[model samples]
Target: MPVPWPSGSICEAGVEQGIASKSRLVDVVLDESIGRSTPDVEHERAVAIFDLIEENRFCPVGDEGGGPYRLRLSLAESRLVFQVSREDGAAVVTHILSLTPFRRIVKDYFLICESYYQAIRSATPSQIEAIDMGRRGLHNEGSQTLMDRLAGKVEVDFDTARRLFTLICVLHWRG
Candidate 1:
């Protein structure tokens, strides 16, 4: 569920509704306040953000006039924050979502990823493939969950959801 947008926000539109491909995010930022990440996590974050910006369909539910928007993602007060703004630095809206729903899946995905990484060094090709398959399955499942959670709020395609899910997991990463 979405928390109310901050007061004095520039949301002339009513409560979030509708999905349109009229807007796309041109920038994605992670909170600097968040702790540092491992090299692997950093690489994942970079790749995810690059892919998301390269091609994505992200239209904030009620924002009109379309985007070229900028998204600043952060975790604060135990919630996930999506601070969206115009290219010229105008506030569009901020969406704060609960992190409880994603905890279990994120944990499981991390476990599988660790297993896959470990297997890469000594396991046979088939064994590595098996671990990779499981990791991808978990990643896909988490992405679907993210899409469901963002439904009616943010319009994003499956590939976009996958990349966003990676970023979300990155927020939880303690490395």
Candidate 2:
């Protein structure tokens, strides 16, 4: 005879069975309070959201909630706010990160990105590649900084942090 399982048991069993625990952003909303951004910035935002949703690992530290979270990103009063929620629309955690720590890296990343874009249009192939390398290095540094800042609040892989960092830069542009 089969044993009867309690409510929510199946879900718990799935976790124990090594079924991947889903932890990701199902939806992202950028607050309109920051005002409109340039088309190029808008494109970067779209791409980052698309790439993040495609593959990411996001688990809120010290929270027992299941994944597929919804995120609302905004900047207010020199702070970056991460409004997180569950798939069912329940409030999860709201993390506010100061912008001071990210200012230098974000500014440098923007500068290198501009150089890389301009190089692609007029510079020689080798020159463009060299600029692109600097751009990538800056991007990595920004991503690592983001990961460090979010250390006790959320856990995300390097690529996830990179994409999130891009979005943060977009917010910073008009913030």
Q: 131-162, model 2: which lDDT tens digit per residue?
A: 98888898898889998998878877677788
- Highest TM-score scorer: 2
lDDT (Cα, 0-100) at 83 in candidate 2 = 91
Candidate 1 residue lDDT tens string, 76-99: 888888898987779988988888
- Whole-structure CA lDDT of model 1: 0.78
Best-fitting candidate, measured by lDDT?
1
| Model 2 CA deviation exceeding 4 Å by range | 1-21
Estimate the Cα RMSD of every predicted model relative to the unseen true structure.
Answer: 7.2, 7.6
- The local lDDT score (0 to 100) that residue 32 gets in candidate 1 is 80
Q: Candidate 2 — what's its lDDT?
A: 0.76
What C-alpha root-mean-square deviation, in Å, does candidate 1 show against the real structure? Answer: 7.2
